[model samples]
Target: MPVTEPIRVGRDTKEELRRLKVHPRETYDDVIRRLIDVYRKCQQ
Candidate 1:
């Protein structure tokens, strides 16, 4: 099994994550992972 962790964010940041979702059913983890992938590509 994989271990999970929690992190805190401001209300505005939470709202921004929701807005970035590709679909209503998408998970925040997916959104964050996608953002991380983009950031990695940009740094290359």
Candidate 2:
């Protein structure tokens, strides 16, 4: 398992995620990791 840290995120992003049903149990770091990975793939 990866070590996770708490991050303060924007309310709009949080609300959007809830609306999209992205499993609220996930840590913010997980969400960031997925987003960054996607961005990295897009850059390739």
Candidate 3:
């Protein structure tokens, strides 16, 4: 089994991630992964 870790973020940062979500129920992990992919594409 994979180990999961807890992370803490500021309320404002959480709100920002909420806004970045593609769907209402999208997880923060998905949102950050999508953002990282986009950034990597731009850097290439």
Which candidate number maximizes lDDT?
1
Itemize residue pairs with steric clashes in candidate 3.
none
TM-score of 3: 0.82
Error of 2 at 7 (Å): 4.0
List runs of model 1 lying over 4 Å from the truth. Answer: none
lDDT of 2 by residue, 1-44 (tens): 77756767699987765554468687556666787888999999
lDDT of 1 by residue, 1-44 (tens): 76678989899999999999999999888999999999999999
Q: Listing every candidate in turn, what is its Cα RMSD in Å to the true structure after a full C-alpha superposition?
A: 1.3, 2.7, 1.5
Clashing pairs in 2: none
**lDDT tens readout by residue for model 3, 3-26:** 767899999999999999989999
Candidate 2: lDDT of 37? Answer: 86
The model with the greater TM-score, 2 or 3, is 3
Off by over 4 Å in 2: 1-6, 19-21
Model 1 — TM-score against the truth?
0.88
**lDDT of each model, Cα atoms only?**
0.95, 0.71, 0.93
Candidate No. with top TM-score = 1
TM-score of each: 0.88, 0.57, 0.82
